[model samples]
Target: MELDGQRKSDNVEDVRGRSGSGFGQGNFGRRGIRFPSGGGGRGLSLSTIIILALIYFGLRAMGIDVAQLLDDGSSGSSSYQQQSNASGAEQEMKVFVQRVLASTEDVWTDIFEAHGGQYDMPKLSLYSGQYPSACGTASSATGPFYCPGDRKVYLDTAFFTELSRRFKASGDFAQAYVIAHEVGHHVQNLTGVLPKFNQMRQTMTPAQANKMSVRVELQADCFAGIWGRKADDKGLLSAGDLQEALNAAQQIGDDALQKRAQGYVVPESFNHGTSAQRMKWFKRGFDQARMEACDTFSDPV
Candidate 1:
């Protein structure tokens, strides 16, 4: 996790405390933020949009302000500041994020070129509280996610704090694993796997859809492993870094989360695979260090 000498990526958008209202979905199209173009995946429907609008606006009307919770104008305890840019430890964290993202760009771009295509790197949006997205409203509670709709990855860095406090997965490498996993989703979108999954999910039963979701998440875990392997090869990983990544993979597994939340596990509703499955797939990718070797769909978990 010694990213001191690493290059920083410029493909980051720092919207940490920029939201004024966090209302109206921020007029995406009007602001030159285009809808999801081409055949990557289906964007949210109009009815879904209406529902989101109602849910958001209704909360505002009832004085149940979720977005306002993010607006901490106080300087001392706040994680973000509207007027000032990132500073102090927050600034250091941003640098670390950029470095990790740059490493992914280096590794994935080379992999993509070897397979006969250019990697259109997905932008990383660092935001706090809430932000309008082409997919939907992204909140801190949603964790880190890749929005195929806008070809970007959204991260609430506060989640890193949560990762340490709640999940017991605390380390810079663990945080890198989370970022790489979401970037792995962007990989799926670019490689045509995501669109096919999206198309098929429409015709699938709830159980079937959940199964597909597990595969999707597991594959992303594998991709994260692939990045980890490359990073280790580049001498970027420390002695215990790999274990930290693996521990993180295990901690966020569907079964692990379900067990923690409800004191039991439900396999049928598991969309991100079990703890064992996540560890296994990640190791598979790390061992092989080959994209072809990470194919969890046809090969079985």
Candidate 2:
């Protein structure tokens, strides 16, 4: 990833080291607690949730029904938003993220223009602890995600450390893959695929909906690979760069994350694909270097 002399994107809003807009002074706790405050609204109280989970289980042991208590409704919940600022080394990384985003803009714009479609550039919001997005309040723990409602990408730079230290998928390209995948979601949003998926999910069973999510996520991975191949063709990829991105796709596979977290893998609960599936789709996009090659929904994922 030789980013020297590359054009940096102007669409980035860096809010690394600053305080949040509504949330006042507070320290991050060891239990991974960081409040998400937005427009003076009450935050999602993790402490309260934990206490409720304990009481719910306690009642279940006492022969009381606790069906709703065990429900994982947190998936649909969004944290409140907070203001932020950036500085020093974070500032450098901010520039790097902008450059990578600019490269994606360049690659995708050319690809779209070649297909007789206009490419609408997306904004990248860099925050520290938490931030507000069209989808909801984004926390650093959510990693990097693109909000289709706002057509913007929310990234917490701390995830770069997770890539290198925890996920063992180290390298600038790995980080770039994360961003590109989120942009890939934006592509789906623009093409009406995302909304269609959302509508279809409403009528599908939980298992069926999870399968659709896997296909959607895998398609995004393939799109990231498409961008990687384009970067390689343009001489932007250095040795091992492709592997860096591929390793990231594999590392974040649903199977891999589930195994690490729970010591088991449940296919029906998988929202993202397995490592093999992820690797396969990414390779598909890299081999073809075209958006049409990433049609995971049309075929069996």
Tens-digit lDDT track of model 1 for 37-80: 33345677776678878888888888988566544554454445
How does each model score on TM-score? 0.80, 0.77
Q: Which residue pairs overlap in candidate 1's backbone?
A: none
Scored by lDDT, the top model is 1
Q: 1-301, model 2: which lDDT tens digit per residue?
A: 9888899999898866554555433542233335465445675467667876798789989998766544444433341111122234676898899889999999889998999999999999898888767787888888899998889999999999988999899999989989999999988888889999989999999999999999999999899889888888878889998899889888888899998888999888999899889989988989999888899978777
Clashing pairs in 2: 15-85, 16-85, 16-86, 17-85, 17-86, 18-85, 20-83, 21-83, 37-81
Highest TM-score: give the candidate number.
Answer: 1
TM-score of 2: 0.77
> Where in model 1 is the C-alpha error above 4 Å?
20-86
